[model samples]
Each structure stands twice: as C-alpha cells, then as structure tokens.
Target: MAQPYRPDDRSECVLAFEALEGALRCLKDDIARTERRCQEVRRAYRQLIEVAASDAELPRVEPDSRLYRLTH
Candidate 1:
C-alpha cells in the first residue's frame, strides 16, 4: 500500500495558516463597518449646521456648549 506525502510538522503548520486567514477576514469586515458609521455621523452634522444658519441673531453655537468660552 502507498502512503500520503506529508511534512514533518504538517498539522501545526496547517492550523496556524487557517487561523491567520480567519483573522485577516475579520479585520476587513471591521474596517468596512467603521467607515459606514463615520459617513452617517458626517451627514447628520451637516444637516444640523444648515438648520442653525437660519437664525441670524444666534452665534451659531449653543450658549451652554463649549463654544461659549470663559475668559482666561
């Protein structure tokens, strides 16, 4: 009977290679999700600033916010 050709450390090498591939796939998915969330935040901010522009008497920032600076 004939036997299969195998490396001296075939089992360890195969498992390590599989683990590395899985980690790379997970990292790619995370990057895509993060980019989408960033786009959503940017759009909401643009809409808020546009609405704030209509009030001429306003200083473009809320009185309770950090833009209302204290004198140093």
Candidate 2:
C-alpha cells in the first residue's frame, strides 16, 4: 500500500511560491526583450529595402526573381 501524501510546511510552500513567481517574472522579461529585438530587426529590414529600392545603379529585378516575389 502507498503512504498518504504529506504537504510541506507553510514556510516551505511560501518559499516555493515565491521562487516560481520570480521565475515567471524573468520569463516575462525575456519574452518582452525578444519582442523588442524582433521589432528592431523588422524596422532595419524595411529601411534596407527602402534604400535598395531607391538605389539607381542596382540591376532591375525581374518579375520572376525571388527578390521581386518577396517584395511584391
């Protein structure tokens, strides 16, 4: 037969809860940082595309080209 489950002391339970809350807070911060970095990357990519489009010396893109497909 299995023994009945025993709960931890109140102090131990409180400590565990606090540790979990701290971990959750750290994870939320990491997610926020990643989202910010992604936005920065997207902004940079758009700026690069604008610069490329305005450059006169660059070869014209064909309709079938992958770059044309992506931009279109």
Candidate 3:
C-alpha cells in the first residue's frame, strides 16, 4: 500500500524533480561527448582499412601506441 501525497509534500517533490532534471542534463552532455569520440575512432578505423586493402606499405605504428590518437 502507498500513502497519498499531500500539499505539505509539494516542496520536497519540487526539489527532487529539480535535482533529477540537473542529473539528466549532465547525462546528456556526457552522451554527446562519447558520441563524438566514437565518430573519431570509426573514422580512424576506416582509414586504416582503406590503407590495408590497397596493398600499400603500412605505417610502422605500434598497436598499443598513441599513434592513433585522433585529433579533433
């Protein structure tokens, strides 16, 4: 069973709603940033694939090196 909300609880409810709204905004910002980074990685992968397909001399970059860091 649940208790009914009353007028006295209105302020608390409003405060909670505001807090939730702020958190949602932050989440949206984080999602946008992640999307941009994913796009960069995808572009880099495509470039590498194209180079590999053409039987060209591959750049001697280490797999675990920072050579693939895509600049914005």
C-alpha lDDT score of every prediction, in listed order? 0.66, 0.72, 0.70
Where does candidate 3 stray beyond 4 Å? 1-8, 56-72
Name the lDDT of candidate 3.
0.70
Q: Of the candidates shown, which would achieve the greatest lDDT relative to the real structure?
A: 2
- For candidate 3, the C-alpha RMSD (Å) to the true structure equals 8.1
Runs off by more than 4 Å, candidate 1: 1-8, 61-72
Runs of candidate 2 with Cα error greater than 4 angstroms are: 1-6, 56-72
Order of all candidates by TM-score, from best down to worst?
2, 1, 3
For candidate 2, write residues 1-72 as lDDT tens digits: 322333567776676677778889999999999999977876775676778779988676677876554454
TM-score of every model? 0.62, 0.67, 0.62
Question: Residue pairs in steric clash, candidate 3?
Answer: none
Model 3 Cα shift for residue 43 (angstroms): 0.5
Evaluate candidate 2 by giving its C-alpha RMSD to the native, one decimal.
6.7
Could you tell me how far off, in angstroms, the CA of residue 44 lies in candidate 3 after the best superposition?
A: 0.7
Model 1, span 1-72: residue lDDT tens: 223435577886787677778888999999999988877766776666667678787557665765333211
Candidate 3 per-residue lDDT over residues 1-72, each given as its tens digit: 323446478887777677778889999999999999889887987687567757757655455656444421
